[model samples]
Target: FYKHMLGRKVIPADLEAFDPEYFSNLKWMLDHDITNIVELYFSAESDELGQQKVVDLKPNGRALPVTNDNKHEYIQLMSEHKMTNSVRQQIDAFLKGLHEIVPPELLSLFDDKELE
Candidate 1:
């Protein structure tokens, strides 16, 4: 469907079968904060070479998303433990910008405190 929608040739079914090697790299990417699926998709579509170019660019994964109920508490814990400056900045930005698109009460669930 994706290839059809985009007017690109569909990858063959034999190739589409999940390769063990691909999964290993995919797992590494997931574990090490490498680019998520959405970012990968955007990068792939943005280029004429699609996935080939996206693979070359190698966008890193975003910082983890905050799931807890208390934003202030999460921030305090991260600050107390001396998290990286980049993580700290991401957290602060989320706190400031979260309420803009989200209901204030629901903001905590979707916000990535460490996302820049």
Candidate 2:
């Protein structure tokens, strides 16, 4: 961070990275009811735990299967979890440290993409 602080580009925002094709397939499944929706659920690993443990997106989320009607909500929840909730603490910590060097007010100068 100290090194980057002096660079031309100080703090570049991290973009939400995802595979387009995966979503394309999801959209296709949503369109075609005939297409069998694969069994899936919103889940993640418990990073805090040393042993492998599953983290459900929400209460009873794991027990619930992804069906046609609920698939839309599933996708949305998945995206939200991955983009925001998953790394929320990490993002906050990073920004807190970053602000010590580069003020948050200065970040307004660069757009989200520009930060990258």
TM-score per model over all chains: 0.20, 0.59
1-116: candidate 1 lDDT, tens digit per residue: 22221222322231223244543443444345332332332111122323323211123312333332322333333222222222345555664665566555553343232221
Error of 2 at 99 (Å): 1.4
Q: Pick the candidate with the highest TM-score.
A: 2
- Candidate 1 local accuracy as lDDT? 0.32
* Per-model CA lDDT versus the true structure: 0.32, 0.59
| Residue 116 in model 1: lDDT | 14
